[model samples]
Target: MLDDLFPILADPDFQKPGSGLMSFPAYVYVYPPDEEYAFREALPQLQERLRRPNVGQNSLAVNIYDALVEHLEEKTLGGRPLLDRILEQEEQDPEKVDRQVKRHARSEEFVEQVASRFSAFAQEEGGLDRSYVFVHGWGEVHPYLRASQFLDLMEPHLRGYKVVLFYPGTYDNGEFRLFGELSSGNVYRASCLNERLEA
Candidate 1:
């Protein structure tokens, strides 16, 4: 949905030259979904629920499910999601099932590469600030990816700054283990979302 990305896309801080999330696959982030509407009305209190603890089994509200179904309505070159197709073929052929599993594994690898580029160090007026990287692991499959993987992916881009990885862990929660680890010895200037956002 066009409205879905406007908050992150239109912000200059997110669209800056070196640290922009939109810098890679510029169009896909803004992929226009037809019949776009606000999720606030449809999902009701879904956002508030995401901010809570013990959010059982990921209580995905109706609108988010609908949006996902809509995203699958238009298939890309990736084929009709190996998970969906494999489910249908589970009883048909076991060998073909193995192939589908491999495809999904590769897709995840591609996701890691794309997510990596969204990281960079910010420059301060005095000098370079702590090197930081943001791993936008939103959506269903993201929580499965670890914070260390994000930190490793961000390693190359750190350059002169210390690499501090961002991991919005949990299904849709903030488990700042990555930040905590980076700041343990006070070695890096890692901070929470609000702290980093303000910086």
Candidate 2:
């Protein structure tokens, strides 16, 4: 499974900044949901192989799910914890709370803010470099934040590195269908990534 990514991972030109091989400085690696464990196990080896001096010492992988949770815990929107507000209103006013939650979660500003936090994890200690950012955990933050929105917001901040978003979904034609949920229409055709690796 890991063999599928070797071609792109080993390409020196792909690692260079502003190479223009792809419209965006990122790639998509699609894998089955069941392969998540294997993917995690192979991450260290993959990082070791892709590691470059200028990239910094931080781990290559960034779990967006974890980042989102941290953001929710540390910051409050509308002067209150988002989760607490949602839950507090759930019992007395479920519908209203739902509407409020949707308004806050799906807003452009919220998405950009979350995306900014996620992108920060990919940066080098003191500056940026030619590194590989392995992004995962799309499934954890699905309805609240779409993968496409985050990717769009991340484009500007990710130009200096090669980002590989590990999507547990299917890329058919051009649309990426998340978690094989055909009814959801969670299909995203992001033009940012240079290539797609399937497992």
Best by lDDT: 2
Instruction: Encode model 2's per-residue lDDT on 90-181: one tens digit a residue.
Output: 89998897677556555566657755654565553744343566778877767655677666756665655666688877666667778866
Q: Looking at candidate 1, what is the lDDT of residue 87? A: 62
C-alpha RMSD of each candidate structure in angstroms: 14.2, 4.2
Candidate models: Cα lDDT each = 0.32, 0.62
Worst 10 residues of 2 by lDDT: 183-192
Best by TM-score: 2
What's the true lDDT of residue 114 in model 1? 38
Backbone clashes, each candidate: 0, 0
- Model 1 is weakest, by summed lDDT over 10 consecutive residues, at 24-33
Candidate 1: which stretches are off by over 4 Å?
A: 1-139, 157-190, 196-199
lDDT of 2 at 4: 64
